[model samples]
Target: MGSLVVFFQLAGAVALLLFGLSLVRDGMTEAFGVRLKMALGLGTRTGPRAFLSGLLATLGLQSSTATALMTASFVERDLIRGRMAQIALLGANVGTALTAWFVSAGIEAIAPVLLFSGYVLGRRKGPVWLGTGRALIGVGLMLISLALLGHATEPLRNAPEIAAFLPMLDAAWPVALLFAAAIAALCSSSLAAVLLILSLPLPPGLTVVLVLGANLGGAVSPVLATSGLGVAARRVALGNLLIRGLGCLAALPVAGLAGAALTGLALPGAGLAVEAHLAFNIALTLLIWPFTGPIARLLTRLLPDEEREQEHGPRWLDDAVLKSPLLALTGASREVLAIGDAVERMLGQTRHAFDSNDPSPLAEVLALEDRVDRRQQQVKTYLSRLGRDASEEENRRAITILDYVINLEHIGDIIDKGLAPEVRKKIGLGLRFSAEGYQELDAMFLMTQENLRMAQTVFMTRDRDMARRLMELKVDIRNMERQSAQRHLIRLRDGQPESRETSSLHLDILRDLKRINAHIASVAHPILDEEGLLIESRLRMG
Candidate 1:
């Protein structure tokens, strides 16, 4: 009964630690997600900057896994080079180690103060304050959990079963390493696993091996999390895993010497596990940072890109369904949805290219635009046959589907012809938007993508409330576009160098994005018209 109680206490403390980590991650994301993304997108111009970006991002997010995943997504979008991404992960590893060191630095005495301050700040209204407060609360809980962890493991210091097991684990370092790796993988956090190791009374060599195992498992979590992503993304994660695995293997035989060295120089109140974790990462970064390019090349050879199916033809349209107008309309609607998906992909790729100043992603936009053109033609031909000998409602539905698909095709064309070229010109000409101008355009790009998604939902469900919301968003988009243009003019008048350099390009892109949003918002029109919720015009009568 006593053993079970102790086990639950340890489990509960670990759970709280994980919860605290989550709160910190969520709070930071809510508060600074966009700016962080922008910073990451812009900060990878050089290897050192990329490394620092990853380090800082991991420090804020409190999870190297999150940092890795974000970096992988950027790679997929061609935002960051593969070599730079590897270096970034190296820095992220160091960041996580630094976090462990800080948490175990005997700071639990102020947990209550932190908790009180966090509660007060969390009660405020704005997202920034709330998120920062929640993060503070998480820090407090993490410190408290560390204190609890120490108390929970006190009984284990003298437990006969643990005494018997420690020798067996120490004797087989490989098994000990795997055991720690499993715990880290289960918790999905090396920081948590290393902290748990700190609480245990074990030989220095054994503890070092356990900490190494946690690092190995930490790298694996990102690879596993990104398994379903694109080949480029998988390569980034896999490359990070390989680096850590190699580091672990190289350090395993020397664990005892390293652990003893760390023990001798340990800071007052700092645990050996924390010291070892930090030292190992620092050593690994120094040793492997210069080899990132070769490692990235090796990864590409190992994980060659696979050819994906082209999205050109209509897969859902069928002649057998043409006999039933309702079934035909359903098939047409589904096909149009596919077109919408294609348009969304094009828009996303273009936006990514614009932000990253990389043209590699634009290749997909061109391919998708061609597919969109072909598929829309196919859809139009298929729907035209259904229009003959159809009821009024069926005819109306067919027209709606046709109109939506046409709008989607137009979006695809604008992305391929207008936005793609404009982004290419910006990249090719080495043009830069002022910070304010960049933020303005980026926000609209995000809003346009969001509106496209909402339009898709409105198309499928025809929900009245959603239709109303879409119409309102149309007004919001117009106002935003006007405001951004006004801001651009103000910047121009101020003679901002970046704004002046990209003046015409900036205004042209803004116009195109607004046009795209207008097309997307048109999906809500038929729904609103049917419900009498749409006004015919904004004209004033005398």
Candidate 2:
């Protein structure tokens, strides 16, 4: 019963620590405008530079997982080379080691002072002190959480069952190392694993070895999370394991020296353990830092799989330089332009299907429509992240363009799936249109195609004049739809022999035509309604 209480107490401490770390990470990301993903875009041109970027990013986010995931994302997108990934992996290890040291050192002792100061400052009625105060509070809670965790573990030192385990830790350092690594991996958090090791009242040498093991296990979480990603991403995760695993191997002789030095250190034993942690990481970084280039090149040779070929399909829009918002915006615009081209081609194919009576062109239109839909999704995802760094004007522009492109893609789907298939069905059944009906249908198709083109133009240029013209064309197309539907009904009432199929085809074509007009009108909506139509629609009637 006593052991159970201790167990729950330890669990509560761990939960609090995890919660504090999460809050700190969130505050830091918000404070930095969440540019960790952008910083990771710097290709591994040089190992040192890549390492530097990784260090800064991990330190900023206070989570190696965040940094590694971002790096893996870059690798998957081909934004970073395999070699850069190797260097960044090493840097991430060093960064995570830094956090462990911060927790172990005397920094945690001053938690209360900082916590109270931050609380007072955080309540100030202005923006200036709020962010700094929030950051300080994050740091304070982070420190206090660790301190509480350490205090919670004090009873473990006196418990006979726990003390019996302490002898085993000293007797079987290697076994302890592997055990620690497994714990780290299963926990999916190196910080938690390190804190657990710290909570044990073991000698400093054993703790140092366990810390080393924790570092090795830390890479496993990201690896498992991103397994089956691109070869480059896999290489990055593998590279993390290689660097930490190799460091552990090289430290075997030093581990002997570490144990001796740790035994000689003063009372609390924290200072010595912290020193070992720092020295190991610093030495590892220095030694591996120079080999980043060779390791990178070697990884390239080992993982030489080609990307799936994209022919007239939406391409992945990842670039190392897109770490910058301006650069990312440029890439997004280029992708949007590609999507626009696909939309235009789909519309053109729809027109050709009408003119040549060829279903093949309509099939091609369906394929292009698929490409447009995919590209729209890709653009929106990239833009949503970019929105963090965007100015108000840029944000508004991005949302507007995305809105227009999404609608335009849907318009293409309507033509390809709705109108084209109806036409193909009629043609396959040997149904022929009357000369007058054919002329009217062709004219309506041409006008709708023109509207699609205009929508793309207004989206790309944000030209208010073009948008206005599109609204006028949208009204004209609606009139055309009404006229076509009425004429088809008249033909059916007149008992035309083919009126059944004709009416079906006419309604499908009219639906497609009207959908295109709606999409065109949507392009102008960023500047339209003249009376806040969206807001007014939600207003309560008096």
Candidate 3:
């Protein structure tokens, strides 16, 4: 009965620790404000920039995997080069270890004060203040949970059944290493194993080895995350694994000497263990940082070749990165841009197919639609996985991106199911647009393409001015569509193919073209309406 009670208590401790850390992770990201996005956007241009970007992103989100995944998306989108991704991967290792340091230092000690002040501020009903207050409340909860975990472990300190296991650590270090690895893999968190090891008064050598193994085992999460992702994404996951694995391999033989020195020179209260972990990560990063070029070459040789020339190109989302919702959302935006480009091409083909009566162009349009569908589904799945791993701020942004991408996919469907059908009907009827009507249709088609491009640009840059321009073009499209539909109706009444196929084809084509603009406008609205400026414009327009 005592053993069972102890088991429950230990389990509760773990649960509390995870919950507390999760809350703090989310709160910190929210507190960092929005500059993080711009930092991410600008940071991945080169190797060192990507390295700093990964560090900043992980620091903000409190998760290294998220930063790594975000960097992977840059590669997937061709925003950053693959070699830069290798550098970023190395940085994420240091970032994750930094998080463990924060955790071990008991940042939760100030939770109560933060909680009270946060609740007081939360009642004020201001956006920025409320967000800050909520973050404080999260910090408080995190502290309370950490306290709960510490109390839960108190029982194990005196339990005789577990006491027998205490002296078992005096044996070979590999036993402790295996135990740490298994614990970390099962928990799916390096912090979990770190805390467990920290709670025990194990020998210095065994403690260092266990922490090393814990770090290596934690890479399993990233490895598993890239299961169905593209080459760049897979490489990101593989890179994380290699860094951890090689770091351990390099440290394994020499870890004893370092651990002995550190233990012998220690100050007090298990502080040496934390210092040892920190020193290990820092030394390993320095060792690997300069050699990232060689590591990239080695990984390239070890892993199979990337299919860079694959049709529809690389998607930005990688399964390994879904844990960081902010990073994943960033990737989804890039993916949406790619899909938008493909849509513009399909629309161009549809326009030409209408005039040429060439099934070849129509077939090409269909192929583009199919490719967009695949990319859309890939992003959706990635977001769903990301939602599972994200903090609340990340979750909110992810939801927005997921909604936007799904909406964009519908635009692709409109071309496939709606516009394509109209073109085929016109061909079958053997009826053609009158000269003036053809010219008007051509103008509208050109405007639609421009609007699509503007929307993609606005999404990429989050430029309110570009979004405003897209809105203006949408209004122009509405007027042009109205005029074209009226002219097509006149042609029908004048006995110029009063046939069902001809009438339906002409009117439907105009409606689908206008609807496409509406979808683009929707995509642009999120960026523009982020501040009150776009809303003021809309009200004035109304």
Query: How many residue pairs clash in each candidate at the backbone level?
Result: 0, 1, 2
Query: Across residues 1-542, which tens digit of lDDT does each residue of candidate 1 receive?
Result: 99999999999999999999999998897677655665665668688898898889999999999999989987885567899899888889999998998899899999999899889999998667888899999999999999999999999999999999999999999998888989998999999999999999999999999999999989888889999999999999999889988999999999999889998996766799998898899999999988998999999999988887755468889999897999898988998998898888888888888877889989989888888899899989998887467899999898899899999999998898899999999999999899888878877887777678779999999988667767777887798889999999998998898988899998999999989988998999899898887777799877
Candidate 1: regions farther than 4 A off: 316-341, 348-364, 374-410, 424-501, 514-542
Per-candidate RMSD, Å: 5.3, 21.1, 17.1
In lDDT terms, how accurate is model 1? Answer: 0.89
Each prediction's whole-model lDDT (CA) = 0.89, 0.70, 0.69
The weakest ten consecutive residues by lDDT in model 2 span: 529-538
Q: After superposition, how far is residue 373 of candidate 1 from its true place, in Å?
A: 3.8
Please give, for residues 307-386, the per-residue lDDT of candidate 3 as tens digits.
53446555677666666666767878888777787787787677667756765678877888888888888877767666
Worst 10 residues of 1 by lDDT: 33-42
User: lDDT by residue for model 2 over 63-163, one digit each (tens)?
Assistant: 78778877886666445666677677667767776776676666876777777776787788533355446656777777776777777788888889877
Superposed on all Cα atoms, model 2 deviates from the true structure by an RMSD in Å of 21.1
In model 2, the runs with Cα more than 4 Å from the true position are: 42-45, 109-135, 262-270, 310-542
Ranking by TM-score: 1, 3, 2
Instruction: Quote the lDDT for 387 in model 3.
Output: 53
